[model samples]
Target: METMTTSHSLRSTSINPANLIELELLSQIVTQKQSANDIRGSIPYLAKMAQIIDNQRLETTVAASSPQQQQLQQQQHTLRLLQADAHRQLGQAYMKIGQYIQAEASLTITIQRLESLLKDDNAATSHSIIVNQLIEGYDLLKECFELLGKPHMVQGMENRKRKYTTPAPAPTQATASKDKSSP
Candidate 1:
């Protein structure tokens, strides 16, 4: 399975010119280290790289305006999603290193940001894409809590997961009968 996007492809097709250089460099580092043998050893470096990308994205987002503002906002949103993915990866790495506290912190950030982005009115991205991301985020977070021996936290994650994954309730017989009568 493909695990990472190459910097070249990201640069050529998706990234805006304003974020080109920084994002390319960050993506290169992330892609190269993704399959490294010493994944736990790479957590700090990966987390720092993700932080740098997020800081740049924040600065660009704050400065957005005028005719390019809408386009820039969309690009920055995409960058934020990438940043969240980096954080999730870093969290998993932290988990491998037995750093439950750090893992929980990183995973919490990923889940929160992803949930926020999924709430955006202008987010025209695929619903399944965002939902899948949330599922991954929550799954990792639940693992982190379990490893930390935090049953309450684990329960919370489970509840959130069910909320997202469970189908809506089927209409009650009374409601169905009322509907037929109205028609």
Candidate 2:
């Protein structure tokens, strides 16, 4: 696993990177650790990555309506998603480590963050990615509720999960044909 050698180097170096490489490396390490069932080992890395993402400042010098500003906004949105993902992974790790309360907190934050992102009209991020993250968050939250012995919350999470996992109603043949004919 990459964690064997890279983990040591990651720990030795300060992890404040202006680029995404460190974030990607941290994510890889977290995934590797989780795959090896080393949930505890991944927690600190996940926490660090989340912190780094949350603290990153976008320093765009252009006007708000400029293309550079738009790109920076997109980058900021992506960073927000990445931060939410880090929290989701941390929640999953906490759940595996039998820390239900911490898991619940992290998962709740992940869901809230994604939900807000879904409301952003200017978001360049795809709805499917946000929806998928929400589904995962709900699933993890369901487990947290189960672990915490909250049956009602578990059912609520299940319903919320279904809301995202359920496909949208397909267009009727008549409607499709009418639209095609009109065009």
Candidate 3:
């Protein structure tokens, strides 16, 4: 039932997250989840939740598999690290109760990043301290997000892959034909 809305890359045409068929399938699932008789759910809220669910499911699926999934997964790790630090500081706001989730999220992100780097061919790419920190954070965030049912973060990232992966447009044959005739 899960269809990928990921855009088609001619290089990797099957991987696009902007896929329409994926959206339609996800839409159907969301519609089925909430029946017509549910009086308390607002239309706007339903729409938002539907988006979140579709996004989360997509995110989880991509995170679990795909070689291309690595790029976005790295970004998520970085984000989770930052979030964990914020949670740590906030934990200071109330010393009695341990901010376990926050700290755990941060550590988790760090470990995940490390594992990713080890597994990656590009592990040699040097990064700044800030980037490193963020990578660690993403690990933590993934855990927290999973617990909170916020898996859509990964899907949101897939949406961004288009910006980084899509190649520049090549000129048409007519343009090439014109260029050859010039001067």
Candidate 4:
């Protein structure tokens, strides 16, 4: 009975299909079966998964989807978070093969997704985590631009890092007094 219960729990916690695909894609890259010239084979599949997850979320928001087909709320959130991470990994794969342009594009998409998430109301509790991801994305992206010999492109990423990670300065005493008097 104990062994049967353990097996049932393991089966219930099986990996997601989309995540399984993503893991296989990453393995291909790691094993050198996928290269810059042929990343097309993997990217489109991952992109489709991301799109499906996104559309599923939208569907749930506007109307009831069949509960049998619907992803759980926690699953949806986890998948959305992984979407950004997968792109970042893809960008690294591109970088490894010296495909700077593709690397830049993939990392930029990752940064954009991370930034968008930061704007969500629920992101408050995870602000530091998101900011760290953004910083890492920007750093990798800057490396891509540098390798591509576009020093100018890196500057923009640097600025974004500063903007995202730096806190605004506190008001000085003079400014605080002026605001107090005006009100």
TM-score of every model versus the real structure: 0.73, 0.70, 0.23, 0.63
The C-alpha stretches of model 1 lying farther than 4 A from their native spots are: 1-36, 58-69, 121-125, 176-183
Given candidate 3, what's the lDDT at residue 129?
43
All candidates: CA RMSD (Å): 8.8, 9.1, 18.4, 7.4
Instruction: Residues 1-183, candidate 1: write the lDDT tens digits.
Output: 966756645343244455656656756766666667666556656777677657653334455467567776666678778878878888888888889898898899899878888787354555568788899999999999988899999999999999889999999999999999994
Looking at candidate 2, what is the lDDT of residue 110? 93
Top candidate on lDDT is 2
- Show where candidate 4 strays beyond 4 Å: 1-77, 178-183
Which ranges in model 3 have alpha carbons more than 4 Å from their true place? 1-58, 62-67, 92-183
lDDT per residue, candidate 2, 15-89, as tens digits? Answer: 245446878888899899988989899999888887877776666563466766767667767767877887887
Model 4: per-residue Cα lDDT over 100-182, one tens digit each? 88788778888877877777526466777888988999999999999998888889888989997689999999999999999
Report residue 29 deviation for candidate 1 (angstroms). Answer: 4.7
Clashing pairs in model 2?
A: none
Q: Which structure among the candidates has the greatest TM-score?
A: 1
Give the TM-score comparing model 3 with the true structure, all chains together.
Answer: 0.23
Lowest lDDT sum, 10 consecutive residues, model 1, at 8-17
lDDT of the candidates, in the order given:
0.77, 0.80, 0.43, 0.69
